[model samples]
Target: MSKKSTEQKPEVATVALVQSAQEEEDTITIPVMDIFRQMKKYFLPWVLIAVIAAGAVFGGAMLLSNSKATPLTAMVGFTYDGIEKGLDPNGNEFDANTLKSPSIIESTLTDLGMDTKKTDAIRSAITISGVVPDDTIDELTAYKSIFESTNSVDAAQKLMDVSYYPTRFEIQFAYGNSEMNRSQAADFLNTMLSNYKTYFMRTYGYNDALGDALTAVDYTTYDYPQALDVFSSTLNSLQNYVSTLSQNDNTRFRSSETGYTFADLNESINTLRSVDYATLSSYVLGKNVTKDKASLAIYYQYRIDNLNRNLSSANEKLATIADSIKNYQKDSMVVMAGADATSSSALTQPSEAYDDLISQKTDAQSSVSSYQQQIADYQSRLDKLNSSAVASKKDQEKVETDMKTVCDKLNKLIDDVNATADDYFETASYANSYSVLVPASGSVSNAVSNAVSNMMRPLLIAEALLFVCYLVFAIVRAFIVSYRRNAIATAAVEAEERKEAAEAAEKTEETEE
Candidate 1:
């Protein structure tokens, strides 16, 4: 139609531009935003699956955690006496090792009616804890709760671990995963205490006939002071009765005076002294009254001698203290007055030394007064002994014999009573130090929060893992779909190019023909 000049427009530029655009488009690069967008389409399904998986995990964990695998706990308390000799015979302070030793466990299990041959079992089941004070049991209780939750491997670890205090110890025993009765726990505790006590008692020699005898003796009844009182009163009453009897006795050679005069006694003593002193002493000793009197006199004389010795010692001490005081005073006076009394520079300030000297002087004077009083009391006793009259030897012999028999019986009773006193004391100490057993609650202490946390932890982890996997799956699917679409577009583009080339070639062939 325009046919004046048929001109072929060069379409090469357009084709090249289109090809270049196509090539640019052919290259597939997925940015992070695209991947997220692709994943967003399946996000709800992924979330659903994750939730379901988490729930399942949670349920499973709960089922396992709530299952009958909890520990049973018992608590027992031991009281310790602070008596060093009784409790620590080995001179070792009470330590946790003594209670936690394998030997102690072996013995304890034996008491529990478990074969000691199964020591490993006992060791595994029982834990002896540190000693604590009586007031701090709550601290141990809180510790046990925390420890049990975290240390699930040995659930029974809290049960047998011991908490020791200075004056006492609290012990915990746990039987793991048992649905036992509270009474059983009580029985276990009692047996444990009994065995533990028996162990110490036997080890320390407290479980013998002597121990029993000691327990039977009452401490309040043991009064040595009372015995002394009885002895003194009996001697005084006997002396009074003998004095009256001597006054009543009007047998031949009875003096005109009510009692023997000093002159008469002196004359008699001289006459007796004229005789062979040894023979007269022997003759006096044959009669019980004279013998007892002579013994009493000798005892009083010895007491007076001891008092004299003490007085001499006290006097010597007083003199030494006095000398020290005098020296201190002299020094103080020298300091106060100065070397030349008129010299003011030489005068010294009073110091504590003077005060100490004055105090010492007062103490020394008090000691002197005490010694003088003691010496006077000794002389009084001596005078009484000299003035007191003994019965005639013949009549005195019978009364002395009767009194001697009674005295021997009393002495025997006194010895027997005193001998058991120490044993009773030890027994009382054992009782005070003994363990007190109470039934432990058998209720399974479930850490509800901990169990839930433990159960939920796995579920949460699973949910996170599954969500990550889902995200990966969704992104991979997006990449695969995008790749397939790009490959189809490229194939179409290549087919078009081949077709175009074929057409050009045919056209050229025709043109050449």
Candidate 2:
């Protein structure tokens, strides 16, 4: 071979080997920076496509949200003044749970002529909360003031903006046309209250008409008392009738017994004629409930005379017995002193006289004691009878007064029912202290506000889907670009290798030639 050819061939081989080695090394050493550099070209296009997709999704979501049907919104609150205590009562919460019970809902639907199949929908749409306290209301009002200063006047509402937490027995209806929603909300509240009242009556043992009537009397004040004053005559008549009944009944009524027999009274009266008339009159005047002044005075005189006669008779018999005993003792002493011996018959006569007088005195004293006891027993019975009569009369008067108050309240409640033309409550004699604090009615912009509020979820979902699609496209496009680059580099390396081998073979053939 010539020196020029030899030098050129070695230089070409070395150059080919270096090129092949460089290609192999480049395939193994493609850095992250290079990959990023390649992907950089697609960044703007991918972002643009993603932005377009997100915009389309957001626009569609807004259109759907605005175009969808808006349900009517109705709001109301129940006042629990008649619930005995604060909101949570024993066994009867009467809050959101009670109002939303199946029985109450069914009853309300029946009364309003709504179908049963609409129950689940109605329930889903309806929202019930507890009553906000006055303090909470004040706080909310302050917040509203602040909100008004910082935001639009239309956004600063008292109740609509507050977060619901199932706090109060406030009901919100949102399932029908405006008119139906409003009417049904009111009807549902009334029915729930009716059910609660029935339960209250049954639990408290208020089973009678009077009990029912008294329930309507406002315990908060004496409005019923003043109203009841008009029925004073009726109340008085009832008391008088009760009094008459007491007087007629033998078990209740009793009169004092005068123990004077006819004959004894006649004899005593004759004996009392000797007493001065002034004394008799004075004695009779001191008596409580003295009837027939002259006759009572004569009776008092008779009593005094009869007692004196009994005293005199008892004293005389005592004196006679004492005399007989004294005489017998004197004779016994004489005989014992050895003066003259008395016969047994003489002693017997004195002893017999003493015995007879002693027996008579005992009989007289016993008769007096028995008569005094009879008079005392009669007085005790009379006092008891009078006390019972007074108590019965007082009880009757109290009951009559209470009935008057209840009747007045019942009449007032009945008038209210009639005025309202409430057929359900027509048979009821009274109502409790419950009332509707807030009636159901939708604001002018409520429908639009609700539709807007419902659109946020769909918008977020669409954006998420668009984001995923963009990411997937970007990752897949990046991989494809990398694969194509690597394939092209490999093909270039193979072509270089083939060219170098061909050059080497031609050079060797020339050398061999």
Candidate 3:
């Protein structure tokens, strides 16, 4: 019984080993050709799924693009000949964000005949950014390295606190929220820029303060002498203005609008002062022209008193300035004229302080002289008023007529000065500081192309992922199908082998019997 059991165990072990070997041999591996064949078989379906996925992605992108409007853009540049210390031509601190101010937006809306209620939308849609150069970082780094090498605390501190503002700026307007079409939005920006330019010119380029002052006084309301004083003051202001312009090297610049140069205007101002103003003053004071006798007496007395006080002050200033000039010591320098040190020359030049003192002394003396002459004139007029009878009607009428003629001439002069000043400023370089370097422009086709370009990368990535997943699915499905078929065939062969082994065993037992 033990022997029979041992033999059966060996037979069972051999059969189990044989079945394991057959199973190992039946393990299927899909080749590249099988994968390729499976992929080809499912190629149309895969293509359809890929097409659907791509269509969905593109459709979503198109819908997203349609929902958000593309912005229209314009470039503007500022160019000024004056010092750029973060100040505009009018000496106000410059801020580029003022481009989208509520006032500007309102003005733009008004100009375009659009409803003002859309101001918020328009302002919100507008954005401004400085167009920085690509080498900005490199330049900044170099600047910092130089300063650090020098160990300059001030320079390093300045670099650390530096804030850069670009001369060029890009303005964008997303008209989707503003309910404006492309053409309308472009016009809005261009018109807004136009209005801003006008505002800039009025605020900074042209100064109407002098002109306003000249035109504001009602000369007819004043007595003859007082009117002459008014005219004198206006002429002085005009003289100062022309002098300032001439000192700025604008003397030869002729205004095409006014047909007058600064030199020509200066000449006109001098002529008015020397001829018209002088003649008017002498005639009025000489004749003792008075609208009211009591008022004239009191005015003359006031003038005399004021002139005496001014004369005293002028005399004191003159004396002090003279003493300063006399006591001032000029700086002296010794220069070697030839190669030999023995040949030396002493040069004594007036210091700036000494020169300034001399200038003050000259001005003080002129003031003193002027005050003395004015006092003398007023005292003579007072004496005439006290001694002489009241003026006749004919005399008063003649004074009135002469004053009218002088006022007319002054008015014409004022007009000419205003025109010349306006023209001069309008043509100045500062007026061209802020301009539309490139006007606002946009195209629908360009917007479409940009939208497509923005979506292209993501679209390609999605399509690539879908293709890879389908390819993996096809290859996996091929392996699974090949494995099942190999497994079924191996099972049938094992069954046949097992049947043959049993028959042989039965035949051997029968032969042994």
Best by lDDT: 3
Q: Evaluate model 3: give its TM-score.
A: 0.65
Candidate RMSDs in Å, in order, are: 19.1, 28.9, 8.0
Q: Which numbered prediction scores highest in TM-score against the true structure? A: 3
lDDT of 2 by residue, 271-317 (tens): 33324222332232222222233443354455545655765666676
Off by over 4 Å in 2: 1-87, 90-174, 177-453
lDDT of 3 by residue, 75-103 (tens): 88788743245666656777877778888
Worst 10 residues of 2 by lDDT: 420-429
How are the candidates ranked when ordered by lDDT, highest leading? 3, 1, 2
Model 1: residues >4 Å from true position, as ranges? 1-28, 31-34, 72-174, 181-447, 506-513
| lDDT by residue (tens digit), candidate 1, 47-162 | 78877786777667556644643333334443544432224533555553354456765666566666567555544555555445554577667667876667653434543454
On the 0 to 100 scale, the lDDT of residue 482 in model 1 is 75
Give model 2 RMSD, 1 decimal.
Answer: 28.9
Rank all candidate structures by their TM-score, best first, as comma-separated numbers: 3, 1, 2
CA-lDDT, candidates in order: 0.51, 0.48, 0.77
